[model samples]
Target: MMHLTSRYLISLASFIVLTSMAVAKTNPACLKHLGGGYGDAECYHGLSADITADNDKLYRNLRATIPLGNAHQKLLNDYMASQNDAIKYCELQRNAGAQWKAEHDGSMFPALYEQCVYNIRKTQSTFLQDLLKMANWK
Candidate 1:
């Protein structure tokens, strides 16, 4: 009886570990949507690093590069407002992912959310670059 119980326990433990791994595996579709340039790791991890660096650059550029003037100030204010809206949209996407019911594992939700955020940030970065051009900044 003792030996049988030990074998059962080992099998149960192995099953749990395998199940956890299956659940935790990143969705390949989500990774591809996010550019899939991170090799073995998921795209969210790479995108997280990218978005952080981009946000830092955007912050610094907005703070120091744009000259102080009425036109520039107006542009900056509008950009900031758009940023706030983008943030809200990103949050909505994240919430949707969290509440998604179709996926059994739900591992793709986070990667999808991160992809959405990455796209938003990338768009914002492009807009900022355009603004820089308009301001005649090299």
Candidate 2:
């Protein structure tokens, strides 16, 4: 009985490890280093930086359009120009990360925090891209 149980456990562990390795390869920048905090954090941070850079370019393109010639147009553009949406997203991610840490402890803190930050940055980038597209609709 003991031998059978040990073999079963070993098999389960191997299956889990193999599954995670497959997941990691699916997205090298974001998932490849997962299951370990430091490597995962590093990968996610780099992914976040890439997203942020893209967002900066999107913001610049959106800003350049600067819907002009009327008070309402200026108001709308100003709201988007101020980066309030991105700020709110970052704030939300920070709060969620803090809550996750409080509940889950530190072994996975880096992975969780970086992944959350990266996700929010990606969302922010998407929003900026959409806004730029909207601006170009004119």
lDDT of 2: 0.67
**Which ranges in model 2 have alpha carbons more than 4 Å from their true place?**
1-33, 68-106
Candidate 1 residue lDDT tens string, 3-41? 999999999999999999765634435554543333323
How far out, in Å, is residue 98 in model 2?
8.8
Q: Best by TM-score, which number?
A: 2
TM-scores for every predicted model: 0.49, 0.54
Candidates in order have lDDT scores of: 0.62, 0.67
Clashing pairs in 1: none
